[model samples]
Target chain A: MSELVKVVVDAMGGDYAPQEPVKAAVEAVTERKDIQVILTGPEDEVHAQLAKYPDYPKDRIQVVPATEVIQTAEPPVMAIQKKKDSSLVVGLKMVKRQEADAFVSCGSTGAILVGGQVLVGRLKGVERPPLAPLIPTEKGVSLLIDCGATVDARSSHLVQFAKMGSIYMENVVGIKNPKVAIVNIGAEEEKGNALVKETFPLLKACPGINFIGSIEARDIPSGYADVVVCEAFVGNVILKLYEGLAGTLMKKIKGGLMSSFRSKLGALLIKPALKKTLKSFDVTEHGGAPLLGLKGLVVKCHGSARSIEIKNGIFQCVQFKQQRINEKIGEHILEMADTSKE
Target chain B: MSELVKVVVDAMGGDYAPQEPVKAAVEAVTERKDIQVILTGPEDEVHAQLAKYPDYPKDRIQVVPATEVIQTAEPPVMAIQKKKDSSLVVGLKMVKRQEADAFVSCGSTGAILVGGQVLVGRLKGVERPPLAPLIPTEKGVSLLIDCGATVDARSSHLVQFAKMGSIYMENVVGIKNPKVAIVNIGAEEEKGNALVKETFPLLKACPGINFIGSIEARDIPSGYADVVVCEAFVGNVILKLYEGLAGTLMKKIKGGLMSSFRSKLGALLIKPALKKTLKSFDVTEHGGAPLLGLKGLVVKCHGSARSIEIKNGIFQCVQFKQQRINEKIGEHILEMADTSKE
Candidate 1:
């Protein structure tokens, strides 16, 4: 039998907590026999949640004790340092020690960002580790890199991000020479500010990837390009606004449907199809965002993530492992660096 | 009657030019007795369109002669400087000379931004002319500043934006002591980069406005904020993403409803309610974004705007004039500058 892909999940984190992660882990292992999950949290709470899911395999699931919890309010660096037994810190250590191939968490994003760097460390030649998420676009999906991880990034970092993001989308997401675009104010090369103008030429000159000129944020969801690269500040804004607007619009639609008796009846008749359509827009189905340029894989799920989100996150790790995404990224980086040296 | 609010519109601009703008102008003048519109384009084209609506007051509508049109492809600066008979340049010159209360265009955004500054100029103490648009929120709408004018802005400029945006929202939009927030990666005061960190303290120190701390983009449409302030780069991203996602979701919903006969029937029954709900999310209904901090009022309608949008853009000018939003913003700036001295 093939070796099982071990994933360390921080079960004590997130709004849904042990229930969501535990349920998701059970679902993932049941669906895939080649994976094992280590649920890190209070042992008793983990087991109690596990007892509810009687159909889950006993050997596939194990509890790793992590008594302390990191609240979102605590300072990131300070929390990671002070709470050594926190789920985020402990799970990250497992990935660093190679006891698990990857770490999945819905914990405080700040703690995860800090712990990922302090514990798992960044890959060589990577100036900053970026949080890259695959957002669903009209044409399948595109990767949005540097989504609120490293702020105040330089132009060179953005150039590197385009390269790293290009490697991930091509190798893992399975797009060939994916169209990489620098997120800018306008499509014209000369349209953006200092950072974009400087990075545009560097991205265009990149040898191994397909560098598209520029993409405005409005063009993103239209799936106009395959890879969208920007600094963390801009990326975060895009990701969050996408989420907020989707949620708001859905809410408005529902409220409008329920406004009158005739509309309410119509809403009931169309509920099934509407539900199915809306499901595609649910961000949780895409899983967690990967901390790109890391030595080991680290995915940050939403803090309010539920069971489905957790399962999708584990599935993401499986894909990352099968594709050997990190190794390919590292090789690509070295190749680019060597060429630049000459 | 109150002094007639004269609004000069670039009638030759936008996708549905003479037809839509002419219709909307007639509607506005007929509905509001205190407003008059000067439609600038070819006199023959304007008169031929006006023939469709005989009930509209002939005296209330006047045709100004302009021979040239500014295509979106034309270089904005060159079009403004060289095309003396162009609708955009001529209409803006009217506003600059105070022959009209405001200038409204659904033409080229780049031309509007450039023309508003070079032709109309900025009010005293106004560092940058920000494109402030009223975005649909759960709590009606909130003004988002610096949507696409100034990038690479400084702390002082942002502070000025907060003061100006706050005044516009409260006075023109009729919100009281509007809550202003600097769009940041996170909510913490120390969370963002140098610009946000520096501007945070300054905004909080300013009087006459309810200064909220930083707002993440995800919190925008949820009505968690009233005025979202940021540099043009970030603001542009937010505005574009909002429009794109809303459009995509609406399309998906329509597609899903038509996929099955039952759902299509349901769609018909709920069409009115759905239309009403969707109208709230429509960008056109909110009118054009004002280029705040400019000496003369300038509003930027969507490039794809028809007559209805043009009408709203002109009507927005009436509110700007009635509330004297610019004068109040100027007064607030002096107050803020004096307070800083103390």
Candidate 2:
């Protein structure tokens, strides 16, 4: 039998709470013998939810009772520190103690980010851990790093993000080399604000990574680069705007198609093909965002995530473990340091 | 007859060059007797292009000879200083001398921005001029201020932007008490970078403007705020991404519809309705970006602009001149100072 990849699931997090997490855990363990899941939440509630899946592999799934549930509205730092027995904190602790290879949550973004950093801790020589999410593009998917964690990141931090992002894309996403590009307002090296101006040359000169030149936000959807790097504020704006505009446009298109009987008939004929095409662009199918550069992998799924997203996120962790992504990142950082010295 | 709003057209500009500019100028003159257009370029070329439209309103259109042309790749400051006889520089100089009420260009963005500030100059007490472009939204449109200008702007500069954006939206776009918003990664006041945190309170306290709280980029396309304000970098990302993602999606939709015979038939039936719905989101159907806070109005159309965009840009300048936008901005600046003192 193959070795099991142990992943801790926060059963009481997200909008759907213990129901979605418990179902996802059962589905994950039932589908794969090479994986084990430890669900952390109130034991009675988790067991009740898990009871629905009678055919789940009882030997692979375990429950670690966590009595407290962290709400999404609480302050992130304080919640992580105070709610020691909360599902989110307890699950992160399991990762910290090496009891689990990875942790997955669909809780408040702030709480998860804080818990990932303070509890899981950063890898040695990693300047900052970036939350890199796979955004849907025309060519497939591209990783957008620093979507929320570090707002005022320095140039050195950006260089580290590039190295780590390249490793993630190459190993987990199965892309070779994975072209890295810095986000800028214009393509010219001298055309950006002070932060971008400072970072551009550093990224251009950095060794061990295939650093492409600046990419404007306009080219992102066309999949111009595999890994797009930017400060957290800009990255957040790009991610959110991408979601907002796509949603708005899709709704408008649907409204247009339903306005008249002729178009309505047309919509019926194209519904199946259109659904398949649009489903590829759905972000949830791509899985959760992984907080890279951590001692152990930590994935933050959307708060409104369903069972499908949670299942994908679990599978993502299995890949992370199988590919040894963290080990590769550690070695890359050491090599980068050596290159800087030479 | 109403007074003629004289607008200077940069004939030696954009991808289509003298032909499109000359044609647009002729069309503008023919469409309205209340407007006159002065074409600036090599006299022979301008006259030759104008000859294509022999039945155009000859009395309302005129030409001024310019011997040189500024390429888009040249350094903006250097081009504006050296290319005195270039069509762009000559047209700007005309605005500076009050020979025309406004200047319209499909030239280099950098050169136009530099020339507008250096030649026509900022209004009294105006800190920095912003490039305000009307972006099409689900509900009409919203004005995105400082799209490519004023990077690394201060809190005070943002406050100024909100005030000016409010004025432009109210006067030109005719939105009453336009809801002004500062773009942020999160919707909370304390949930932004240093710049947004500092500016939020000031905007809330500042009188004479309708200052709404923070707006996430996701809400921008739904037209949540009439005036969406941000530093140039973030604003540029939002603007460009909006265009890029929309274009990519539309192409993908078309490709999907053509993939099969049933879908193809559906596409044919829905063609007219979808075309009308999609046309409302077209950026060109709106006008050029107006460089606000200038003593004389200057509108910069897209570099790839055609006759339709140029004609709309000409009419945009007429509105600015008719509404006395510059004079209103001047008064707003003075009023802001009085409120600050209190």
Candidate 3:
């Protein structure tokens, strides 16, 4: 191998950090011989956890020293500026200076989003960077772009999002000609507000991407389309609602199953199958959202992410790098921008 | 008793209609002595369904003459205009002409929304009418205003929605000072787009309404606020997401429970308690959404509504009429408009 794909992970970030990230990093390095993981945090805490995973290649994993941790309550930009020695800031710097192929953080979302933009920077011709999260559907998973960034997005930005998102889904997710759609108030072409009405015709006109017409929120869980595109405001609503409702319903069902003696007996028999089925809907099984249209790959793991979530997020970076998703996105975005100019 | 509240029912609407609406009409009139229902549809179908319920008071449930039915596929404005003698059209006209206290239809949502505005007209000083649906939550049900109508809403329109929804929740839902929150991208007061930013201060300044700060979609099911307000586009997404996610989760959980022998036994004992708990989350129990800020009280039931949904919808009309929701909304709107002018 010419060189190992070095990945920097903020081990001190998230709710179950130091433990979860350390465990996940150990697992990831064991599976992929071509990958090197730099677990950035205080060295002693990391070493203590490493002892638990004696089988993981000690040579493949290295500790990068960092002293600070960014709390959720701290101001995003200020924390990034002040906490230069923080795990999140140090990890981002590695990606910026080209010491690592990608940066993974299960830390504060705001700080990650800010650092991704201010530090790593955007790819050329990209107006706004979108947070594209892969949501599980009956048919598999679909990409929801601009989940929490660029709230007041324009039609041009949406057109760019559709193109960039299509590239990633096809290259990494293995979908051919991923069907792209603009999330709207209705299914009809002329049914939405000014942003949707203006963007509908543009999305339809874009020749390279498979622009499916409008998609209503109700059709999303049914996997009506592969790539659902919208401004951050609408996208955020869809993503959060999916999370909240899923969590609420799952809790209700679990409570109902344990309510009585017969149900308790029934639960014992089907516990294995129920566990398997519920695992499929678990959001943690899916990796962190990728901040698309960036110069280099950046993924924002959930703030409360455990080891499995962190490993999945880092694994996502490996695929992103292997497929050269960034180069293709940059090329595609440039082509669209040039054509529009002409 | 001051004359019984007469509710016009579209007997030919919905999937199981003529039977479902007729059945619900009978049940509603039987249960509540203070209400009379006029069944509007082809006489034969209505009489055939009525024949099954001989115990129903014939005088309280009379059939109105209507020949045509508005199919769900028909264009809303075209159907309303062409199908003059259609059950939906005739039923709405009764409400407009003051011959009925309210109109309940499990028919075309588009037709109802269009007809409610075009035929019944909006209240004076009302910029746009909103479809306010009562969504069941952990605390109770909340009124989600502008679920389908008024796409490109302005600050003034949102302010009016807050006033109308607050009045409805207070008088009809029986919540004092019903917390009103403008749906936004973030919870902070400084967050949201141009429309939300402009409307926030206006809502806060209004005298009678209890204007709470922003509420994200995740906060909705947790019952963080009682009255949620948004423009039609956002509100439609919230409503559909709630329905889609709830339905999908229920299906997944049921599938999981039936997958094994032990779980099947467990499911049986807890089935009763589970049923009771799930029933509380069902949107049908809450009935139809009221088209707020309209000159007359208009309620739009789901297209696939069954007997229970129809019955609940009609019962909701009793509360609407009793609380005089329309009059209160009209008065609030006029006062706000007058004050804003000065």
Winning model by DockQ: 2
Candidate 3's docking class is: medium
Model 2, span B67-149: residue lDDT tens: 99999889999999998999999999999999999999999999999999999999998899999899988888999998988
- Determine which window of 10 residues in candidate 2 chain B has minimal summed lDDT: B276-285
Q: Report the C-alpha lDDT of model 3 over A1-342, residue by residue, as the tens digit.
A: 545877898889888888988998998898888788999898889888889976878898989989999987677899999999999888888888888989888888778888889988899999999999998776778899988878779999999999988998999899999999989977888688899999999999997999989998888887788899998888888888787777766566567667777666665766786687778877667999999987777888887888788888888998899898999998888899889889
Clashing pairs in 3: A263-B266, A266-B262, A266-B263, A266-B266, A269-B262, A270-B263
Docking class of 1: medium
lDDT of 1 by residue, A226-276 (tens): 889998889999998888888899899899999999999999888888998
Ranking of models by TM-score: 2, 1, 3
Candidate 1 lDDT over residue span B266-315, tens digit each: 99888999999989988778999999988779999988887777778888
For residues A132-239, what per-residue lDDT tens digits would candidate 2 score against the true structure? Answer: 999999998999998999998899999999999999999999999899999998888889999999999988888878988999999999999999999999999998
What are the chain A TM-scores for all the models, listed individually?
0.96, 0.98, 0.96
Q: Please, what is the whole-model Cα lDDT of each candidate in the order they appear?
A: 0.87, 0.92, 0.86
Pairwise TM-score winner, candidates 2 and 3: 2
Q: What is the TM-score of each candidate against the true structure?
A: 0.96, 0.98, 0.93
